[model samples]
Target: MTISAELLPQHVAIIMDGNNRFAKKKHLQKGDGHREGKNVLDPIVEHCRKVGVKALTVYAFSSENWNRPQYEVDLLMKLLEETINEQIPRMIKFQIGLRFIGDRSRLTPELQQLMLQAEQRTATFTEMTLTIAVSYGGMWDIAQTAKTIAQLVKEQKIDVDQVDVDLFAQHVSLGDLPPVDLLIRTGGDYRLSNFLLWQSAYAELYFTETLWPEFTTEELDHAFGVFLGRERRFGKTSEQVQQEKIEN
Candidate 1:
């Protein structure tokens, strides 16, 4: 049966965590887990497309990840380059707009060029959007937004008194898309881990014990089911919301 798009989240952001733990459990190297997790990404993306999800954001790497072993970091960079190069054609073919949110200044110039190429190639796409959060931290995004707003203030583009939530949101990286409706964290983690701190302010949080490498479409559905069972009051009483709808 085709799941109703309304039942599926319009925008879902996932923190792809627990790769190292998954690897350790399987008696494999840490990078091996990440490699295996990479294999699952395409399938998850396809599942989101199938479910009519408008936008999907994945926490691929964090700004703090730079503290990891240099060798692992180097391997991850190579993997990121290879993955983007391999996936661009597929993304374009599938009409999935590709977006990257993070500090690209930390990436190698070659890799940064590849990222730009991917974004440009898929810019015309209007289907689903797949955003990878690489070298990203929610605090960094917020700080960057503040810095931009400060610059705008200096330029006299807007009065400092006019700064508000909506204006700040406009400067966020994923602001063009719908606010995050669901946020998923896998591998037993129960925290946001600095992914989309602003966007997920009212998002439904779903945590699964399944590792990223083992997470499947069925698991995705389970998360959706969980979300569907919730009541989104959005700061209003249920009775108040119902009454407002009735009045409308």
Candidate 2:
């Protein structure tokens, strides 16, 4: 499917799912599925950059994911560390800016340092931004932002009356980037799963049964094709939107 250039999403966020299921289906260890899922991300990211996506945010690990078996969690952390270390060169080569969102305090110092180093190394890249959400949750993001705002208010940095939706949003994760234009969740999930509550307020959502390990560029194009067919009216009626477009 050829997605129209004009209808391409500026920012796309994905909730990658079903790695374990894919592993079980293949009669392989769960870790193998995660490894495969990790491998698939590079091509998808490259495709997004090639197709002019400005930013791509992926839900890597959620705050709730910590409750999983210790072995699995440890393997995931190890994979993340190794992937970050390995992807830096590719990110530089592709001129992609690497950024991480989520609470960093929970990460080991080594992993945190590696993440920071990766961000610093690719800080000058301008072609596209790849944000990995590890230990992240939509509610946690909101609460953290609110806490920051509360601190500022206590410090007399801002007045209580000054708080508004826009003002409050500025403190949330990815506050500097464009709002999520499309949110894709793989593995047949229909719910947001506390992925990006504040950022996806009006995002066009696409859910697919394809597992993360098998989600390909072609599937991505299909999602974009669907996105192009939808009419984004925001709060306006279709007639009003069409008339405004004509007036413009």
Candidate 3:
């Protein structure tokens, strides 16, 4: 399935899930699913770029992921390091800028170094942006942004009354990217799972039973179709929304 030109989202975010469960179902080791999922990331990201998406944000790892077994976490970090090392050239070839969002403190020095290298290598690309959220949480993002805003106010950089939505957003991760127009979750999930709370306030959401390792371009096209059918009011009445112009 191909996304219709009229229905594609400029900015799409995804919560990639069910790797461990999928591996268990297949009688594979816990980390095997993650490896398979990682293999799929490059293809899906390229698909998004080809389909005219301006930005893509993927929830690779959450802050709560640290609660998992130490072995799993270690394996995941290693997988992350390898993914970055292998994918940087691909990102550059696709003209896709890379950005990392989330707490980097938990990552090992080597992994952190790889992340920086990936971002720097792809910084000049402008066709699209791919953000990998590692050790991320929606509430955590908001709390951190709030703390930054408070500190700014204390320094008299801005007044307390000046802290509005736009100002708050400036401090959040990937604030330079446009608002997320669509949010999808794979693995039969139906929740946000602490991914992008403030950014996805009005994003159209799509849930599918396909696991992260199995999500394909066709699945993404179907999700776009579903997104097209909805009326995005953005807190306005239907009558008010229809009167406005939305670019395809």
Candidate 4:
């Protein structure tokens, strides 16, 4: 329930993978795997909030996911909509803000409406924030930020030379939140898969063989343990980091 402040990750990101594989491995119906994965998030969210993480971001859908089989895509969309509907009250119950960061144009109008309303309903919760990346990709998020910066340049709001990391960062999705301190990928993947590329520039990465549906609070704890056991030096040498820690 409680963790050391120095070891706690203010922001955590999860690449929830292996739903279809879980289905095949379990001999379940075609879409049941996704449904099972969907059910796994609530407790994780609660646990994150309980452990003092300010923000939790999950990869729900990606821009590239549109290429999946139409039926599978449809199932994902339905599940997303259901997730929004189901999470709004839970968000309020836990005093957590719910947010969605991604391209909304590709979503159904009805689903978009639901997402907007859910965001509105939970906008005031300040204890923690849950961000679902739907139709989201790191490349897309950065491109959108670039486009906004270019538009501002065109409007002469600021000089083009003024565009820097800080300026560009402010325009990126979830820029107001803490940078990702821990990124967890389930299902044995060792790659980022284009999720939160910029936000997780210095995050501690945790990979696990457990499928998403099987990922639990215990797994999260293990990831935190791994994070604490390692050292994040940023660009500093080990000696410098250790000296700084001693000074603090």
Candidate 1 residue lDDT tens string, 1-248: 46799778999999988788889999997699888888889988988988799999999889999999998899889888888987898897799999899999989999899999999999888789999999999999999999999999999999999899999999988989999999999999788888899999999999989888899888888889889888888999999988986998
Ten-residue stretch with the least lDDT total in model 3: 239-248
Model 4: per-residue Cα lDDT over 1-248, one tens digit each: 45875569999999999999999999999999999999999999999988888999999999899999999999999999889889988998999999999999999899989998988998888999999999999999999999999999999998989999999889999999989999999999799988999999999999999999999998899888888888899999999999998999
Task: Point out the higher-scoring one by lDDT: 3 or 4.
Answer: 4
TM-score for each predicted model, relative to the true structure:
0.96, 0.97, 0.95, 0.98
Task: Mark the regions of model 2 whose C-alpha exceeds 4 Å error after superposition.
Answer: 1-4
What lDDT does the true structure give each of the candidates?
A: 0.91, 0.93, 0.89, 0.94
Tens-place lDDT per residue, model 3, 1-248, is: 66654468889999999899889989997789999999888888888888889999999889999999999998988888888888888887888899899999988888888899889989999999999999999999999999999999999999999999999888888799888999999999799999999999889999999999999888888888898889998789987777675431
The deviation in Å at residue 24 for candidate 2 is: 0.7
In candidate 4, the residue pairs with backbone N, CA or C atoms under 3 Å apart (3 or more residues apart, or in different chains) clash, namely: none
Model 3: colliding residue pairs: none
Backbone collision count in every prediction? Answer: 0, 0, 0, 0
Top candidate (TM-score): 4
Local error of candidate 1 at residue 225 (angstroms): 0.8
Sorted on TM-score, highest at the top, how do the candidates line up?
A: 4, 2, 1, 3
Query: Total backbone clashes of model 3?
Result: 0
For candidate 1, the C-alpha RMSD (Å) to the true structure equals 1.3
lDDT of 4 at 139: 93
Summed over model 2, clashes come to: 0
Which is superior by TM-score, 1 or 4?
4
Q: Which stretches of candidate 1 lie over 4 Å from their true place?
A: 244-248
